[model samples]
Target: MNHFPLFADLKGRRVLVVGAGPVADRKIALLLAAGARVVVGARAAHPRVLARAHAGEIDLRLGEFNPAWLDDAWLAIAATDDRALNRKVSEAAAARRLFCNVVDDPELSSVQVPAIVDRSPVTIAISSGGSAPVIARRLRERIESLFDHSLGALADLARRRRPAIRAARPGLRARRAFYDWLLDGPVLGALRRGRPDEAERLLDEALAQAAAPPRGRVLLVGAGPGDPGLLTLRGLRALNEADVILHDRLVDAGVLSLARRDALLIDVGKAPGGRHEATQARIHALMVSHARQGRCVVRLKGGDPLVFGRGGEELQHLRRHGIDYEVVPGITAALACGAYAGIPLTHRDHAQSLTLATAHRRGGACADAEPESGRTRAYYMGVERLAGLRAQLLAGGLAPDTPCAIVENGSRSGQRALYATLENVENQARRHAIRSPALIIVGEVAALGRELAWFGEILDGEPATAATARLAAA
Candidate 1:
């Protein structure tokens, strides 16, 4: 941020170059591309430079360094092999107050050329002044990998259709949201295949259907637990189509970034163990209001909505209001936490059955929760109610010696884990500093960590082993 950003107007401006070597040749190319009329002031030219002069692309002068070269020039470059000559060019340009770049010499130059990524109409330039051109070039190479050339064409198409979209949506927010949908949806494919026309046609069709701007439809989208990548394609489609996203506290930011930029993001999240009625009511209104006005609304929820994610309740509300809606299933907490953490929900030697139960609240106390019969049980949000969960499981005849594991921040970078028997699960989890966004498993199959742990080994850079606590902290 040391230097302010500026764009120079080069069209038809004169550029004077004091060398015809590779360095000067590069400067000449950039100037010519910017449409600057270039004059090479060197006595002899490289074959390429001589060719360019003969082809009338540049005006070549046969002479030693001369101060008169700066007379009518907007910019000048001193790229000669002789440092004395380069210094002379610098002093001449400075006296005349003209911008000058002395090749590879920062102290004598007014400006330094930068490494550039040009997808014309979408150019990215990286510069370290003249201090580190190598670093600048490396960064440019990295940036060049992030965006494809098709983006320029895609942007052009959108620009070309601005008038039509304005006529169709009228509202600024609506128009912006429509473009967001296009960028996140099939338009990218069209642009990649060199089908801008088809992409434009499809977009026009979608906009035309917006005769009323596709009314808000409630989509119960599962933002697969905490791992953003686990979200389903259908869920991604819902997010892209949404005009608003009503999310909970548990939904990851990485997942939310996939939402339309202009979409209204409403955080209806509740505290752990807090009431959800008000949140649900507010979500209901946003969905209904936008839908009534013909907006695509997305009710973004973490984990599989049907599996204790209260997705059914939202669906029920949408149904009662007669709102168009559908559910996009996300990777459930039970499967995601256990799988990514290297815990097998069902193992051949120890677990013959799998079960999932909420540990947060059950009718009043965890004691009131139903006992799931299985070799393994994944308790969601159950840390605070662990004692109660243990009692309920013991009461249901589960063995106290059963292996149990806790996985926190499953599949996220800071994931932690703890492994212990059912009798010591809560205690071990506490000692190991297990926190929320965690899943607890109790059953013989949990002991299968003696084998099936892949993610844990990858994380610690160790070979797979029975003692890796694979599922607990993976």
Candidate 2:
């Protein structure tokens, strides 16, 4: 509520980034990507920034931070960790009403940066104010796994043909319906296989047969979190036929690899570096354009599209537009991450109610900004926000003694888990040096993990054994 949710058009804009370290480098990277004329005020910069400067991509000012650095700047970022310096930079920006970030200090920031997942032509952002950056980042990562680089090509196809499609279909609803079909079907499959020719051919055929273009339909494709092996048959089928894949950052890379080679793989993923409505709009447009062109369109997403994937908004859009789209369910991160990490999402005695909560607000504000209420909780982006999450859960009718389990890199090699009671989980995670791209499950069932876990048995540094004993126990 404190900040407006809007994309700042950085193309041809001036952005001053104060700092040359990782955080400074991070902001500068995004500015440059938005086609801004970026200038950096720092004593020294990372090699990547230096390379950009040498290549004439940025203007770098060496040695220290100064208020004059804000002169004539359209936007600024106080990437320095020095709170004092960040505050000064922030004050300068506020005087001019120019946007600025104080890195981890949102209180001093005029703008807070969110995690971004970019596949050109399509981008997604996830924020959590400054309360839990790690959780926001993990959520972003989950979104990223749903799409690939092919989305650029998908966007290009639609852009090239938008005028004709609109002209042919006078009704916005009808036109949107047509686009919906093309995206989820042939167009997607064709592109995924690196066959643009096939995409065009199938599109023409479908259009020739339809009154307008093809009808749009909703698909419920499941992207099993982190483990490509966990994807279902229908999910794989849907992925191959996608025209516009709208995904989050936490999806598995291996799952994305299954998409057709030339498919219009979109990264409608919200994470750390990329955030914008342009990408979201582009996704809808791509679906509409392709469906109108009589190309099969797929709105591929991470997990079940209905679960925090915002499939509902899309369905509404499709309905209003009179597009025929179907919902293809995906494996929600909680289910996949928990199962693969040796923890069931729910159990009879452990959890009477299961809740999925976003660790962030709509504009990337932390849960502290507006803490969610839940019991028997499983958090999608709670790694960085563990402390906040723990506090919130404790306050929200959940006992402080509730058992919690942290799953990192679930469903794939390198998966690790940390189990503890609610009161000690935050400290446990800190003590164990846990990081982002992890999920937190809190409840009694989480305690059952030690007893019911088989994934850990496989990873327990012991060969798979005791089949007879396991059967007897079961």
Q: List the residue pairs that clash in candidate 1.
A: 43-63, 210-213, 214-294, 215-294, 215-295, 216-291, 216-295, 416-473, 417-472, 417-473
RMSD of 2: 17.5
lDDT of 1 at 425: 69
lDDT of each: 0.77, 0.71
lDDT of 1 at 411: 74
Q: Candidate 2 regions off by >4 Å?
A: 1-220, 243-247, 276-278, 363-375, 456-474
Q: How accurate is candidate 1 locally (lDDT)?
A: 0.77
lDDT of 2: 0.71
> How many Å off is the CA of 309 in candidate 2?
1.4
TM-score of 2: 0.48
lDDT of 1 by residue, 72-150 (tens): 9988899899998899999999999998888888999887777888876566788888888889989998999988778
Q: TM-scores of all models? A: 0.68, 0.48
Stretch of 10 with least lDDT, candidate 1 = 457-466
